[model samples]
Every structure is written in C-alpha cells, then in structure tokens.
Target: SVNSIRRTSPTGGTSGLCFKKLNITTSSYRIIINRLDRKVTVNYRPARLPFSRHSLYVEDTGSMYLIHTPGGVSMQWYHSTGIMVLQYITRYNASVPTRGLCGCCDGNPEDDLKLPNGTVVREVGDMMLFLQAWRVHTTDETEHTRRVGDNCTTGDCSTCLSMLRQRAFTPCHSKVPPEQFCDIMWAGDLHYKDHQCDFLAAYVAVCYTHQVCISWRRHNFCPLRCPPGKEYQPCVSTCTSRTCLNREYYEETTCSFIREECVCRSGTILHRADSPYCVTEDRCVCTDNEGNPRAPGEVWNGSARSCCLYKCMENGSVVAVEPDCNSVPTPLCEREGEYVLDVLEEGACCPKKICECNMTICDSEAPPCDNGNRLVIGYSALSCCPEYRCECDPMACPPVSAPDCREDQFLVEVRGQKSCCYSYL
Candidate 1:
C-alpha cells in the first residue's frame, strides 16, 4: 500500500457522492461491482515533482555567496591545481631530500671534487653558473658580458684548472707553486676584459723575481748603483753591462758607517740609496782616501783617473769644483783684508760684475783745494780756528780801506799793486 501511494484527480463535481457521503452513515468502504458498472474513471499521479520544475515556484531567498571567498570552491581548486602544475614542470624528477641527505647524487661528491692542486670544482662551477645566469637575466648586455668574462677568467674555474695543470707537471711547475699559479690565473682572467692584465702580470713577475725592468728607449745608458747620496741622478752612463742604477754598493771607509754620513767621490755626488739612479760623477772618493791639494776650482777625479783642472777664479774662492754645477766646492774668499768678506766676484752684482772698492779707502782723498796753493793743511796740522769759531763761520778781521798816508799809518805794497794801506784799522 505504501509503494502504491499516489495522488489522483478529484471526482467530476466539487461535492461528489464519494466525498459527500463520507459522513452519511459511513457505509463500509469497498470497491463494489455496482460502482464499476456506473462508468467511474481513475487517475494516478507521481508524488514528488521533477527537480528542475519543482524549484521553479520556490523563491531562492538564501544569502548570496561569493565565488572568491576564503576556503571557497575556486580558491581550493586553484591551490590544488597550482601545486600539481609546479610539480609537473620541475626539471629533476627525483624528490630532493630536505633533511640529512646530500644534494648532489653524483659519485664526485660536490665537496670532495677538487682540482689536481686541491682547487674546489664545486665552488668554481657555482660561480660560473651564477655569473652566466646573472648575465642572461640582466638588461645590460655589454656589462653582463664583461662580468661573465671576469668571472670565467679570474674566477674559481680558471684558477682551479691552472692549479690542477701546474700540479700535474711536477718538473715544470713554477717555483711559486700551483696555488700561486691559480692566484695569478684568476687575476689575469679578471683583469683581462679591462686590459688590466698587463699590470697584473707585471706585478706577478716582480713578486716572483724581486726585480723590475724599465725601458727608456731614448736613453743610451742605464745606471747600476747610484752615488753615495745622490740616488736620483739622471742616467748618463751607457747601459752596457751596467747594473740597475738603483742597486746598492758596499764601501769601506775609515770613518764609522754608523757615525759618519756616506759621501761620494770627486767625480760623484751622494746618491741616496732610496733613489732610482746614481748621480753621475767622475769618481767616488772614499773617506779613507788622503786629502789631495784640490785647487780652488779643481775637481777630484777618481783616483784611477787624472785630476783635471775645472775652472779658475780670478778673485772668488771656489766653494766646490766638480764636473758640473752640482759638485760641492771649497769656498775661497780673497785674502785682501784681515776680515773675510763674501764677495760675489764671478757673478753679477747690481746688474754687472765689477770689483768693489775697499771700504776703508772709499772716499779717502780730499776734494781738490779750490785755492790751488800749497797751503793745504796736512792731516796732522793744528787747528787754526777755535772750537766755537769754525773755519766755515764768518771771521772777525780789520776792514779793508783805501790807502791813506797818515803819521801813524803804515803803507805797504799789497797784492801786486803798491798801495799805502792802514794796518789793523
């Protein structure tokens, strides 16, 4: 009965006998043959309606929900799908260990793989890869190329390779060894792009040999050791079989090296040890060498060489006499007076070179006497005028008068004419 449950259409009238007689004496309900013969129709219908049509009449009044909500369908789907895509696109198929296992599975363990000279390949590889990647990703192509070149040449890769090669050839290995070779290779590689490798190479050469070679094509000579103190002397000597001009030379002297300053010979000047060249001189005289009689302007040639006459001074004392102006001279002052005065006899004084008169004799002669008589007073003559009455002052004397022949008057020939003049008038 439950399985057969169904809804049926109502009878033809609104109040049919079946519906109205339900409360009238309530005859036993039964399907009678008489009702069947009266032409009664039966209708059956489904209890539940179809899903699409059933909800059409119902109002969807629930609160509206967003597709992008947190933990929503879209979010969950995206998260799951993204993870799966990433896994699919990965290069290495094997799962990488996150815990204790080593990253590299190759027999040449990253840590253990080293160059012949113990240069680590892993480090070099890493550097190379990093530089390549950076260059590829960067916008600046030239700069990126330069960077790549620098890393490749001077980086660990080149260094490791060089070191390995150096170690393999024991006999031909550099005295500096493979490590130094690696360093040099790296330096060269790094600086090569900039054309700075030459400088680096020079530096390396100097380090290995402890010497430097300089070239001056214009100069004909190269000096060996410098003079005693003049170490920066210009290169004047020929370069043939010469030592470096800056080289040090040992000398024996009677004076203690600790107490006395080192001096150069007559033909030489003191070239300091720190300078690059020795001051050129005829000869270097030793302290123990005897003092020769060097004239005012004479220079001391090396003992082996002849002493040459440099220049002569007519009046000046030669302070120093050497090959050139740089030589130290023995000062020679004229011994004219007891006092020794420094007179610039050779050089110009007041725009000209002239002998200066002796100070004592300057203006010594008295001006010519205007009277022209031999009555000039000698230096020893006694003073005729009193101290208060100077010779230059007006003198009190008898007034000149015409000759007058009086009883007490004395007439005498005055000057060239014979005239009677009053005396003491």
Candidate 2:
C-alpha cells in the first residue's frame, strides 16, 4: 500500500509544508523543515548509481504551492546537477501547491542554483540567503501578476523555471568526487532488499533493529528513529568495507540472542549540565575551546555575555530556544482563569485553545409543561448539563371536548395557549 500525507498551516499565511512520493520511488528522500529559521533540508540517496537529476519545483496556485524534484534530492553524478539542500527566509509565511509554475530544473546537466542577477551560491549559508531572497522576489512577482489579472499557469512555468534557474547554485560538497565514497554509499547489496532501512547512511547515521545479524552478511538493518537530543550510529563493519561510515568505536549492547546493538551518538559530558547535547545529524554546537556550550546566534570572543540566547514564552512556560535556533517557537495562549482543556500537538496546524470554560447550560430550565404535565429536571452526561422533561398530570388541565376528539384527548397549555392533543391514548 502506498501512503502519502500533505500538511497545510491553518494559522493562515504561507507557512504550510507537504511531503509526497515522487516518480522515482526507488530512491529515498527526507525533507526536514525548520519553519522558524525558514530552512528546508532535503536528503536523497538512490538505490543504484547514476541517479537522475532532479530540481526542487514549486506550484503556487493562489491557494497553495508544491515542492517537486524531477529525479530526487540527490544531486550526484554531474557536478552542476547535485544540489540537495534548500533554505528560504520569507516575510510572509510560505505555503505550497499554488497555481503557477515554480520549480527548479532537475535534468539540466549544467544546473546550478543562481539568481536572476547572476549571483552564485558556493556554500550552504549562501544558498540559504539566495533562497530567502528568491522567496521575496517571487512573492512580489506573484502579487504584481495578481494585480494585472493574469492567469498564473502552473506546472513547468517560465516564471518558476526562470526563478529556479536564476537561483541555482553549486553545492559545496559537489566538489568531492563520489568515486571516493560512492561504492560504500550504494553497494547494491541484496541482503538489505527486504529491510526498510532507506539503507543509505547519507540520511541515517546509524540504525538498530530487533533482528540481529548473522556474521554481518544477514544483518537486519532496522531503521532507528531517535528522540530529541539523540542520533543513530550507523553500524559499519570494517573501514575498507563498501559500507563504512566513520562511526566511533562505542561499546555495543546485546540485543535478543546476544546480538550486537549499535550505540547512539552523544556529545561530550558537560560539567554543570547533566543532560549534555546528543551529537546527532543536523546538530553541531558552536562550543568554546573549553567545551562550554555557546549560542550559535551570538559571537563569543572571550566572555559568555556575548552569546545570543532567546528568551521565549511558549504555552505560558518559559523555555530556552531550540538548539541553533533552527526552529520556530510555538505560540502560547494565555490561560487567564478558565481551565485548560487540551493543547494540540507541537507544530499542529490549528491553534488549540489552551484554556476553556466549563460547558454552559441553558439558562431557562423547565420544558414547557404540556397536556397537563409537570416539568421534571434531570442531568445528562451526553449534554454535560441539566435537561428538562414533561410528565403527565391528568388533574392539572381540563379535557378537550371537540369534534372528532379521542376520548383521551386533553387540553394542554403550550406557550400559554391551550392545545388539543391525545392524552397517552
């Protein structure tokens, strides 16, 4: 069964992101988005060599936009083709799947993320800045197009293509020849066929599984999903082997049947801080020579006061910002007096009411007594409040004597008016 999920930001603005399976399904790609820092990292690894070149594409209809890469996020094979990372800073929130052609080129052998003014990005930082500037440019361009009443044609549009081409840049890592590491990265081992480990160490550093390996040949490469502050240690056998990943020689644990288990990555044990940083992918602390943690946003010359620290209030609780400030702070809803019902999961689309009052009951009680009936008040769990019912009282009202009236007919006062009705006949 093929499963796919698309997410949109309900808080309005263009802050939504989505994930989908591309045409090249054999290769695996992971998209990590940091909405706060406006950075998006796309990691791709092909099952085989000579992977197709794919560029990041976006289709921005007035409603939404999309991110597409023709082949995959892996930009290997060709020097100019491999650009797997993209980061953008935007004034307005970035939404996707809008109705316009806004994607990067994948098949172009000479492809490079550049700007219209011929600015080239040589490093990751430059790439981030370029993408941020591109977003502003495209947003302005889109607004202008909207004002002119021009229908934006989506899917392989010139505007998108131009932006993609202009904003193209060569990744810093492309300079490294894949031959030095390609075989180890893609060994095309058949043993891992049944296993679901994207099997590419490029994306996952280490993996552990319930099934143990038999002599390293029949290893069950189980993918490990680490919690915050931790990362996997890709289990590599020998350095000369085709799958070497430069992992540290940490003590291995014994799983079921005395099988070896890969150790999780960890940072140096800090003196004062008990919970030291878990050295993992996407995490590298800007530390001082003394091994003290330093803020990435702040410059450390000699003192700690210069360290940039974020003081944020999230959900009425003050907490330090995420490591490296690569994440957006979740908004907090003040809980004045009312009791809190439930908080939506972190990064959820809709704003969950942090606090809410008890269920309100109807002010007017007694169901109007009808047909010489008396009102009975009761509580209901379904309604979470009190409810009313009418019980018959034959002596309360006189019987209705009208043409074609049943012998059991009685006059019931409804809304202060007498009405003829059968009395339980």
Candidate 3:
C-alpha cells in the first residue's frame, strides 16, 4: 500500500544507504522518496480533498501560504507576521470543520466554528477570511488554554507578542501641558464658586480621567482662598481678592441696581421744601439774593430797600405837575376908572355926550340945536332967548314979511346990526 511502503534509498554507485519506514496512520501525510538514479520525489496527501491552496511560510522574508482544496477549501498563515496561523474551508461540510489558528493562541484551531481563540473566521466561496479578533485565555483545562469568548485575556499568549511588545496607546497629553494645570484648576474653581459646583466637579473629573495632574500650591481648592496677608471675604459687588476668584467665593449685598439719584443744579430752589432730595418733582425756583417779594415789573436787588422804580406816562404828559395849577389865573383890576372920566370931559364924545354919571347929556340951554345955528347969550334972541334971530335960528325958517309978522313981532339987535326975530308966541 502506498501507506505501507518501507523507507528505502535508491541503489546507485554514489554512497547509497537503506532506510526503514515507520507506520503512521494519519489522514494527511508528506513523504520524501529517493531512487537509484539519485532522484528525489516528494508526495503530499490531505485528509480532506480540496484544502486551501494558500500556506503560511516561516521564512525571514514575509510571505503568505495559500492552500486550495479540491472542494474549494482554503487556509492561510504568516511566518513572522503578527497573525501566526489561519485555517478555513469553503464548503460547510468537510474534514476537521474548525476555524483558523488564533493569533492570540499558539497554532491550535479553535473548537467552536463561530469563534476561534476569540478570533472570528468567516467562510467564503472557495476561500476563508482571516482577521485578528482572537483573545488569549488561560485556564486549568490547559494551563495556557485558549478560549473563544468575549472577555478572553491576551496576557501570556505567544501570538499576542506583537501587542505586548509595543508600547501602550495613550492620548496626547502634551497639548495640555502640566504647567497649565494650575490655571485649569483655578478656572474650574472659580467657575464652581460663581456658578454650579457640580459643573466644576464634572470638569475636574474629566481632566483626571484624561490623566491631567493638578497640584495644590495654595491652601484652598479655589483660587480665591484667604492668604497670609489677605482675609477671605464673601464676594460682594466689589470682589478684590484673588483667592476668592479661584474658589469663586461670593457674598451678596444690597444693590441699587435699578435705583437712581436725582439732584438739582446750583442756583435753583427746590419747589418741595420738605423733601431735601429731589425725587419726583425736581423743580428749581429762581430768586434774587433779597428775601423780599418781587412784583412783576419790579427787580429786587441784594439790599433790603434796593428796588428799581418804573415811570409811566399819563395822557402823553409827565405826571410830575400839580393838577390845580394846570390852567391860567384872572387879572387884578375891577373896571376902567380914569380912562372913562377922561373920555366924558372931551367933546370927542360922540352925539351922545358921556354923562358925568356915565350917561349922555343934551345941551337944552342953547336954542334947540338945528341944522345951522349961532348963539348970542342975551341980546340976540328977541322972541326966545339967544337964538331967536331968524338967521341964527337952529331950524331953517322962511323970511317973515311985514304982513306975516304982525301977530308976534320983535326987533333985536345983535352984533351992530338990527335983525328981525319971529316968534310964534
């Protein structure tokens, strides 16, 4: 039988030797046979047909071995690659139906089809997919046992040597330097003091988780702690201390946030005298220095009697003159005394002579005064006193002839001539 062929060396002139064969019954085998002509033949048999064509090569240079089974099964392994071994099959039914070797374990195939040494191998058409999903497990079953579970350990596994040999993976701590820890802590403390302490606590917790180390240079956790020279006062509207800022220490005080003060300007008097400060009505009454009451037209001065007088006109004239002396006075003399006496003596008095008694007097002693008349006192007048001559008569008379004069006839002589006078006695 091809399985029972004894180990025999080929007979040839060059240093030939005979070898005995041992019986080994395994489903798969690899044999090397030598012939007399110094020819060497190697044969391989797989327990199940159609094994993966890919194989793992353990040479210095990295290479992948491929095994292709007749039934479309495939297996792959790497020599010095982090992944130690891998086995897979294309058909669901086949020889040792196990997953590929675990990278977290030695070279043993995983018992469960689903999980292989914590590595998951999936079967594809005529191929198997290998990935690093395995974890190491050490238990009593095999002191260094490999299991397929979620919480498998990779501590002492040879296949996990790569992971163990490399340094641990940590986040970038250089960006947030150690020197900035004080500042970060101070800010957090201030925030906590002013706002919610929980927020600051959460922030500190996150920083610690990220490996940020904080130092305690100050006595208190907050930056605003009472120092040697300074005292801790609750933060009021005016917070001057630096430590209080760190701890976010604050004190509430009464604040006139919405209240405002009202004041009057200089030279202004407050209308409301009772209230000294101006609130609602801030009126200012302008006044002079004197306390006297000022009239509408009057201006008050600094002195008590110092008042300005205003002049007003009445009927377009000044009001300074007395009212009784406004008109002219009567003359002193009663009547025209001497002037009237002088006028009566002179005949220059008209037809009516001025009487000594202030009345006009007629001259009756002379013949009744006629149009033409001359007067002789005693002799010239025969019939009637002086003016009895016809020619001297004041009235014009006709000449008396002898026959007409016999009734009353008289003769009179006057001025060296005889004259006839006629009288109607």
TM-score of each: 0.19, 0.18, 0.15
Q: Which stretches of candidate 3 lie over 4 Å from their true place?
A: 1-28, 31-62, 70-72, 85-143, 146-425
**Tens-digit lDDT string for candidate 2 (159-187):** 22222122111121233223322233223
When superposed on Cα atoms, how far off is each prediction in RMSD?
A: 48.0, 25.8, 59.4
lDDT against the true structure, each candidate? 0.26, 0.32, 0.27
Query: Which candidate leads the pack in TM-score?
Result: 1
Query: For candidate 1, which ten residues in a row score worst on lDDT?
Result: 76-85
**Candidate 1 lDDT by residue in tens digits, 1-425:** 00111112222212101111000011221111111111111122211211112111111000000011111111000110010001111232233221111123233455443333434445543555433332322222222122322333345554344433532234323444445655554443443423322223333333323222222111222122222333222112211111122224533222100111113334443332211223443222211134222223344433344433233243323333434433333443332322333433333121222233244632334433221122133321222221221121112233566577799777674421222222333
Model 2 regions lying over 4 Å from their true place: 1-217, 220-278, 286-372, 377-389, 393-425
Using lDDT as the measure, the top candidate is: 2
For candidate 2, the TM-score is 0.18
Q: Mind giving the per-residue lDDT tens digits that candidate 3 earns over 283-384? A: 122222332222223322232343232222322221222223223233332222211222312221122223132112312244443434445554321122
